[model samples]
Target: MSTLLLLCNQKTVSDTLTDVLRSVGHTVIVAEDVFSLRTKTAKEDPDAVIIDLPYVDALFEDIKRMSPRLPVLCWMQES
Candidate 1:
């Protein structure tokens, strides 16, 4: 199983996803904001990440600089 870091501000969405991932055996760490996201990403060095936010372009670039090899899955809302 992989350690997955999840960055999502929406409480309901984050909670539901966390439960689902944990049930499947992956260790999921949640970060509700940018500061925590960077802190956890640097400290935890998760195998992958899931970004579910309204704006992710800048954050996505920032994360890449921190961990170029880390895989990212971005969740965008339909307009």
Candidate 2:
């Protein structure tokens, strides 16, 4: 299984998703803020990433400045 890095601002959301991914056998690293997100991505180089889309544009801009090849999955809630 591939490692999954999750970037979310909500603690409960990050915890829940981390637990679920770990249960499914993927190593999970959850970051609750932008600083941690950058640090983790640099240190871990995860196979996949899941992020909440609230700050998608800003985040992607930062990500592009840093690493354009990184895989990102922006999560969206359906109303």
Candidate 3:
């Protein structure tokens, strides 16, 4: 029963994962773009962050700086 911050730009990907995650009892908060990432991280203080995107090199550093202790899990899409 933990809250998870989900950062996904694709609508389909976000919707699918959000449903699955919620079914398992996790409270999922979503951020479609980088602009919302900072706000969500500060406001939600989620147990972990799930980045569902093809590229995350630019975001890894930002997430670390915001919440270094928080767990970050990346979900790479198949090509």
Candidate 4:
């Protein structure tokens, strides 16, 4: 399995995802923000990223500014 990076500010969500991925035998890394995402990418070079997109509209510019495109899994919190 490939390495997956889960980027989410919600600790429970990210931690749960990590547990599931690891259970399936994929290595997982969790990052809480764009900065941590970059830092983890530098170290781990994951094959994919999962992010919560609740505020992605505000983050679009920054995401686009990133050098390379990464596969992303998007989610939102329900109220």
Candidate 5:
């Protein structure tokens, strides 16, 4: 099973995604914001990351710097 870090502030979304991923036999870590996401990424060493936020270019760059081979999935919310 792969470990995925989900960076999302919305409780409902985070909870749903976590449940789905876990049901599929994947491990998931949820981070409520960029700071915690970064910290968790470094600490957990997840296989991939899913981000739902605005202005995520810098975060993507930072993740690449931390783990170049890491896969990232980004979703933007409608304002």
Candidate 6:
């Protein structure tokens, strides 16, 4: 029962991910932006982070700084 921090700005994507993760017994915390993401990351100390934001690289660096050992999974759109 690991807690996961989900950073997504899109409503549909966030909702879908939250539901799916919850169904699999993983606790999901959704953050729509970097501010919330940082706050939640500190408060929750989630096992892993799933990011689907506009600035992936920058966000990833920030997250790494906050929690170096924490696992991160990034989602990107192919264009």
Best by TM-score: 1
What's the CA error at residue 38 for candidate 3, in Å?
A: 1.6
Pairs in clash, predicted candidate 5: none
Error of 6 at 69 (Å): 0.4
Instruction: Give lDDT tens digits, candidate 5, residues 1-79.
Output: 9999998768888899999999999999889788999999999999999998786788999999999999999888786
**lDDT by residue (tens digit), candidate 1, 1-79:** 9999998877888999999999999999998689999899999999998998887888889899999999989988665
Clashes of each: 0, 0, 0, 0, 0, 0
Task: Report lDDT per candidate.
Answer: 0.91, 0.79, 0.86, 0.73, 0.91, 0.91
Over 12-59, each residue of candidate 6 has an lDDT whose tens digit, in order, gives: 889999999999999999987899998998889999999987798998
Better of 2 and 6 by TM-score: 6
**How do the residues 1-79 of candidate 2 rate in per-residue lDDT, one tens digit apiece?**
9988898766777888888889999999887688888788778888867888577777767765677788888876554
Error of 1 at 74 (Å): 0.4
Candidate 5 or 3, higher lDDT: 5
* Candidate 4 global lDDT: 0.73
- What is candidate 4's lDDT per residue for 1-79, written digit by digit as tens? 9998777878887788889889999998888777887677667777877778577554544543552576666678886
Ranking by TM-score: 1, 6, 5, 3, 2, 4
Report the C-alpha displacement of residue 57, candidate 1, in angstroms: 0.7
Poorly placed runs, candidate 2 (over 4 Å): none
Could you tell me every candidate's TM-score relative to the true structure?
Answer: 0.93, 0.80, 0.89, 0.75, 0.91, 0.93
Q: Which scores better on TM-score, 2 or 4?
A: 2
RMSD of each: 1.1, 1.9, 1.3, 2.3, 1.1, 1.1
Model 1: weakest 10-residue lDDT segment is 70-79
User: Poorest 10 consecutive residues of model 6 by lDDT?
Assistant: 70-79
